[model samples]
Target: MKLPRSIEEIRSDFPILSVKVHDKPLIYLDNGATTQKPVQVLQVMDELYRTANANVHRGVHYLSDIVSERYEAARETVRAFINAPKREEVIFTAGTTASINAVAFSFGERFVHEGDEIIISGMEHHANIVPWQMLCERKGSKLRIIPFSDQGVLDLEAYRSMFTERTRIVAVTHASNVLGTINPVKEIVTEAHRHDVPVLIDGAQSIQHGIVDVADIGCDFFAFSGHKIYGPNGIGVLYGKEKWLNEIPPYQGGGDMVASVTFEKTTYNELPFKFEAGTTNFTGAIGLGTALDYLTALGREAVAEREQALLAQATGGLSSVSGMRIYGTAPGKVSLVSFLPGNIHPYDAGMILDKMGIAVRTGTHCAQPVMDRYGITGTIRASMAFYNTEEEIDALVKGVRKVTEMFA
Candidate 1:
């Protein structure tokens, strides 16, 4: 597949593209951290605040009604985005961290027991790993890790062997934020189901790459962040099967989450509302809906193709640089390419890149366990998005080469 010659049109939609850093045009490659929002998403949030700002599900006035309608519409949009079976299966949270925590707190409390096991892969972000650890610690359950091979791919045989009747949950990342390895979630979920273990997929990195079908994967829970998919921050989604969601207890208590609260007892609301508590991020959710729409209009297949080609170009270009060591050389990876230059700290390299107006992330990327597994401190990560262009990749290559020349 041919790389996009010019992403000028798509880049124009993001106002931040015009930003100047160090007297040079910004070359943003820190997409894995959080993506630049499109004009459409910003406009949607602006419109919501201007015309439809009000508390949802409680007000009867015109503005309140409109706000409530838009808020619910955003939930529906998220439902379709992940191809979730029912709208009630979609629950909004602060971000992937909170979403995962909700599942850990509610489902973990009910299902987990002493001597039970929760399986996680070595490449999991702290959001996915720490919650399960806490749950296991609280419940006297054991936490098992699925080790990865030297090439950064999960060891399937080892993973299969880890499953047993005692395995209560299998939580893994759909894609590694640091390594860019796209996991075989469908296979993992199927294997876990054979033993009747629930699976939760952290999709913070995968959602922007291509379409994510919760039904197809058959996982019990899927979590992703809005900001990583070109939406506003402080908004995310947790998709669970209707049956599973119905079974899990409420994570929080608040006004909207309760159907009736009396002096003695209270009843929780239905499906999603039972979990969602307090005033939500209304404008951020609206922005998330707009972001999903923007990505849908661009088409998933096209976005995937473009990003894969860019990954190929980036890997190929960087391979030739002397003294440069790239991590996550696994096949079927995503748009991220992480590496370390000889005798150079990733933070120092990141500072040098910033001087050249190339923004990239450096460090453990919230996957400190993965770093510990590999015996490395950290890496320099350049993650891509659909709106990025070949020129940006070229700039990244040039910047790396310059860094290598100076350090190596």
Candidate 2:
């Protein structure tokens, strides 16, 4: 079967392309931060606001029933998207950070004892790193970091050596947002399981890349954000193994998370509801469902092929430029290229590209330890999605060349 040659049809659905920044066509390459929403996702949210706007699982009225039905359907969609075991295993939170915090606060408190060790990789974003640090501090546990090699791959030998009886949890990113390195998560999870340690994978970057199945990966927990996957902001998912979910305590206390309350004691709700406490992002959930549907319709094989082609073209073109140093030269990477131009700050490079209406992220990318490992402050990151075009990449190369010439 033949797939679409170019993503032009998909790109046309985003209305933001009409806007001009500096009388130049906008070239959006900051997809690692967040993706532009398609018309279908926007329309889904609009339809909810116009017709079925109501709080879910609270009211018995007609609109409430409709909203609640859609919300629950969204959970099913997420379950299918990740190939999770059941709908109840999916918990909705604000984003990846909130989901990780839920696990840290609930599971950490219950499972982690003093002198126990929590292992994480050095390539983790602050969202993944800080929560475990805080959890370890509170529990009087120690945080162990698995260092990366000079080529940007995780030090597997070091990671395996770090595992011991006291290692309660192992949390790491499936794909590094800054480095674009896709970690061998299946191997990591399997190795951790051999030591009787649970593993959590931060899928914030991997969810949009291609296919992901928690059961297939054998991860105890997986987390991702909606906005990064073309859905609305303030919505995300946490997928936990049923056994693990059953063991963890409630993350927060409030309306829906409780079964019965008394002056003396309280009984909590089951599985997912025990984690989701307050008013949730009903519209965002509906939007995320629509986004997943759109992506599924496109097919993961096709998305992966197109994005890999784009990455090859972009990386090849950038390598031809003088004084361009690309970071994250690992053998297998996603559709992102981080680089530094000789004698130019990443912020200055980003500023120059911004004048040409090119949008790219330039900073530590919330992975300070990775930056420190590379012995650099930061790199200008150009992350692409399947909807991006070759013409856009050409424009980016031209802009970077111009910046280099001017700065030189």
Candidate 3:
């Protein structure tokens, strides 16, 4: 499988891209919410459930062995994808929400004291914010937010200044889901380390954009979702440094997460298994592996270039629309666009685009604090993926123009 030379070839792998919506060809520009899975991912997951479905790490049966082996193989795939030092550092969870929650609970229990503070940013998705808020509320700690510029870039100076003796941990997003801004997480990690604080990056929106080397970024922990990257919905990854994973107590205890158990005394499993409790999403993990395989075969650099082209087209075309207000005009950003055209509600524009079979996301985008910062309810978001084309961006631009004229 040589890398795709054009968007059409890349689009062929995803069957849903061929479908019609409202009797019009579907233009999927909402990849940031959840990407449409390729047939490769589907086939891999289906094969597992069909032939090798069984409880993993428990039975000596052939099916169980096959399932368990494949499941761990998937873990290796995840470890390599993020460039984690050890495969055991990659822990599977329901999604990014669950991953962040696990870190907040276990890390908070270990380190966060009553007067301590957890640092996050104004641009964070609620998944990153609320968990720390919950942890703070529980431990009588404080939640401090690093402010961003109106252009949607995080203020590093503010980030540096916010750290104090009470600052226990720092959690920030690698990229803004709503703003399309790519944060300097390496510098963030370095700055946090200067104050002897460990940093965790929310890579939910960043992973699919380009290479995310956690070691290179020097982050203590990283979390991202599979669904956002053309994989299954129920699977996500949490990559923690072995030292941190070793120190934080298990977030949950059951079945595979235990090493030995008696009625009175119980011993927990090692590294990854200590976090993976009860029935694991073995099938979903397999699908995620396939998704990563497909993505890598396509070439990350090529995909990034194509996405940037799509973003350029979308941004340039939409700029011509009267009263257009594009958000997040940072010098450095990924290939996604979120904007408002006049005072027209984002939902209204999004619905109109949907009617044209031009799919786009609207509303707070699960980042209400961002909306509050801008003193607006929400903006329409059109996030691009490698499979997206200039034609789709054209359709979105045209749809936006039509929507704006209707309201004008």
Q: List the residue pairs that clash in candidate 2.
A: none
TM-score of each: 0.98, 0.98, 0.98
**Rank order (by lDDT, best first):** 2, 3, 1
Question: How big is the positional error of residue 307 in model 2, measured in Å on the Cα after superposition?
Answer: 0.8
Q: Which 10-residue window in model 2 sums to the lowest lDDT?
A: 1-10
Residues 164-242, candidate 2: write the lDDT tens digits.
8899999999999988999999999999999999999999999998999999999999999999998999999999999
Question: Per-residue lDDT for 180-202 in model 1, tens only?
Answer: 89999999999998898889999
lDDT of 1 at 167: 88
How many steric clashes between backbone atoms does each model show?
Answer: 0, 0, 0
Q: Which runs of model 2 end up more than 4 angstroms from their true locations?
A: 1-6
Clashing pairs in 3: none
Model 1, backbone clash pairs (residues 3+ apart or across chains), number? 0
Lowest-lDDT window of 10 residues in candidate 1?
1-10
Predicted candidate 3 versus true structure: per-residue lDDT over 230-293, tens digit per residue: 9999999999999999999998888999989999999999988999999999999989988988
C-alpha lDDT of candidate 2 relative to the true structure: 0.92
